[model samples]
Target: MRLIAGVDIGNSTTEVCIGEIDNLGNVTFPASASCPTTGTKGTVVNVHGIKSALKEAMAKIGKDVSDISLIRLNEAAPVIGDTAMETLTETVITDSSMIGHNPSTPAGAGQAVGKLIGFQNLGSARQNEPYILVVPARYSYEDIASVVNRINGMINIEGIILQADEAVLVYNRLDKKIPVIDEVKQIDKVPDGEIAAIEVALEGQGVRMLSNPYGIATLLNLDAEQTRKVTPIAKSLVGKRSAVVIKTPAGNVKENVLPAGEIYLSGEKDISVNLDEGAEKIMKTVADAGKINDITGQSGTNVGNMFERIKTGMSDLGTVEKSDIHITDILAVDTLAPVKISGALAGETCLEKAVGVAAMVKTHHLPMEKIAESLRQDLGTDVVVAGVEAIMAGLGAVTTPGTKLPLAILDMGGGSTDAAIINENGEISMVHQAGAGELVSMLIQTELGLEDRHMAEQIKRYPLAKVESLFHMRLENGQMTFVEDSIDPRFYGRVVLLSENGLIRMEKDIPMEKIVQVRRDAKRKVFVTNAFRALKTVAPDGNLKNVSNVVLVGGSAEDFEIPEMLLEEFANYRIVCGRGNIRGCEGPRNAVATGLVLSYVGEMK
Candidate 1:
């Protein structure tokens, strides 16, 4: 008997499957294991992870690495996926600035228009002119209230801007109440002697006057052109609880269309589409290109920089030159990315329209040859680069119980979603498309404004809950569960991920329902959309309805909800869809590894 191992290096992990072939060319799986991928997939650095996983798998069956006679490595797809947020719109404060943010408890309700005067300058203010007090954090709430009250009627104090979190305390102490906007981190940025308008919405509501361009114009006595210029500033304050817009002599807030740049597609016909035209047009242009031979971006633009970065990184890792690394496919998704507005008094961010793109770069020569040779040198075993990943995955997918020939498989990995079909006659067809789990995580991170990538990946993988009490928590499905132990106080009243290691609290104050919505929406946008796009490309006659049974295999296929989502979607087309159980033992993983061994045994036969 000859023992062989199959190692599949994926975007996130490396999987290994060990099998023994008898004299009759029969093969039986013995063990399997996985570990985090050491570096980018299909690179020489993957040899470390490949060896680690091989040892782990051998140990599972009480064997040593020397016992394995041969190692089969899946010809890892050369496609490299990279995601970037291309902001189409940017808020630029030219000569003026604004502070529009949601403070926890902004005091008072109503709009106030006055000249922005420092607390010290309040003493020298003109009695006839209305002035807004910009108080520094050095003053106590009592001191600020006392000073504002002392000059309330005498100096016409109309509003208050506090540097500290004392809006409620100061507003309550004032004899004459006025709109109070607090938590101004950059309080010093507020220009002195500029006309300013402050608005505080009623409890549980957003600011009105400041959120409207016409309202800002009416308050600041702006002309038609000036009102048009401040529209972006008004848009930035739409959902704010409290806001302050200041009018300097030459100050203006302008929303500029960023030079996101254009993408050139080379195929049957060279086509170019500008990024400012949005995702739909870009995708349409991509589709019209028939088969994308290569893709390039406009010089000196966001997309240009993005492609250059991707190519440079790939060239650095593999034998391919930067010029030879061509982007084979791209998935452009419309998104609202939270981008910081430039020159804003507060560190405020606006939901700018953006296109989140995932590009796949493919090279003429397979990059896996180097990886296989490196592993052979280290392990001192005959390492052979096996069949294409999708083809091999299909061979293993058919091993699923109740599956037969003419079956289709969707292998949704971190870097790409690959679809393949194995017909009864043993003919195989496959297509690889950009965007998958990584893109989904990117969307979740950007939409939720999360800085922690681990949190985003965990959120994408697990369900969420809200810690209502020490004992009970409400799940995303609105079901409540009580635990015996007291939950951590840190998770109290916060949205948390129900991970295998217990509840992980999210630092952001986003609501449980919104988090759930965003999580599911991101999945739908990437996986579901890519499912249709990929299936159409590989299905018989390029039609999904013509396809029958589809077995999902890969890390993402094990997602808690993605399989069900695909099930619901494919139901309309009468396609049998579910996650694959590789060899009736492995669930939605090790398909490519298992397929590698199976293909080798077939060659032996």
Candidate 2:
């Protein structure tokens, strides 16, 4: 009797499977285990996670590490996923044309249009026209109301805009009922004599007029071309509870092109392409470059730092020469990055157009031999480095109950989307594409403006819910779930992470609907896009129609929606796609580990 342990180290997880080989060379596996990868795969640190997983598996069967006959560790690839999704695009703000941003609390109702004037000058303004009061934060509501009520007898005071949170107090104490907008931190920046429009919606609702391009055009009396130009401004102001728009001179709205810089693809002949043409054109150039020698970015630019970081990190690894690292694939998604407004009435952000690039670099050498030698010395057990990861995954996937060859396996793991096709003759053709689960998490973090990485990770792992009331909450799908006790006041009327530890408030000021949209859109961009990209490479004639079956197997495969998303995307080609079932019990895990044991048997042949 012999007990063999097959361990597979991944970008995000490490798994193990223990099997017993009989006298007839038949293997019966009884235990399997998994844990988070301790560190970068193929490094000395990974031995910790591998041993931890093996220990867990051994504990299941009441056995110790010494009972294991042999340990098989995977030959991990050199490339780690760089989840940088940054882009560059340009937009110029003409004067103080618009203020579009979220303010924690806003008060008032309806819209007001008036000639802006200094609050102190209200005493001297013409009584013939309506005027909007601009109250600075220095003055209390008592003084503001005292001045405003006294002026109402002289002129038609339409509405009030305050730089402090006294809207309700002033509105309640006033002799007249008018819309009030507060928290205008830059109240002094409002041009003294410019015509402006202010809109404040009722509680739980958002401003509509200023967010509409036509509404701004109508208020400013601008022509068609000018209205079209301010569309971005209106679009950015969409969910604000209140907004202010002012018009400036024609040239005030500047036009500047965002310089995303250029990339140099080193091949037989190095060719450079501007990143503004987007990832499609850049990748087409890379495809034409046979045997990518290297890739470099322009100096003193975002792309420059990205490439430099990858090179420096690879250099720090001390295994692969920095010069030998080649970019194998790139995925670019057009996205908007939020940038702070320089000076504005409310805390404002301009959505700048950017290209989020996820790049995969390939190295000429495999760094697994060093890891295997180190593991052997540390564990007091013989360790063998297996062949290519995709090949092992495909072999393991064949163990699925109803699997047969000429089949393609979509090994959707964090850091990389690997695909492998096993022909009828048992030959394997495989490739890896960058952008996976971690990339999805990066997108969620950036789009939602979350600085906490752990919060973003939790959002990626769990479904979101909005705490509508104390007793019940509505989930992302609009299903209502009831809790016996009232939710924490901080999470009330807010989107929350429904984690195992209870509800965690999403600190961002975005709504539940928007958060759900960002998360789903991100998953679609990474998984749906990479699925087609990965399958096209291994399928005959580079067509997805040729591949009949796709079994998803990886840490991400267990996701509630990813498999469904891939299935929907692959439905067009009539390909049968589903998550892999390894050993009929390990849903999408243990495939690579199970295959390692089978591959060791193959080596004996």
Best candidate, lDDT: 1
Tens-digit lDDT track of model 1 for 51-81: 8998999998898998999998887776777
| lDDT tens digits, residue span 1-605, model 2 | 78998889998899998988887788889899999998776677788898889999999999998788799887776676665655575444544466654566655688888878778887678977877788888888998888778777678777887888888889887887777878787787777777788888767877788888898888778788878877777877887888888776666445554456888878876788887887567667765764556678897766777678867776676556777777666666666677655334455666676667677777655567777788788778888887777788888898888888888998888888888899999898888887888878888887777886788778888899988888889999989999877777887888888888988888876777788788888889888988887788778999888889888999889888889988998999999999999988899998899989888778766
Candidate 2 segments exceeding 4 Å error: 91-94, 101-143, 150-159, 185-197, 201-235, 245-257, 262-274, 279-293, 297-322, 345-347, 364-366, 484-490
Q: Tell me the lDDT of candidate 2.
A: 0.79
Determine which window of 10 residues in candidate 1 has minimal summed lDDT.
249-258
- The global C-alpha lDDT for each of the candidates, from Candidate 1 onward, is 0.87, 0.79
Candidate 1 total steric clashes: 0
User: Candidate 1: where is the Cα deviation over 4 Å?
Assistant: 21-26, 90-95, 251-261, 300-302, 316-319
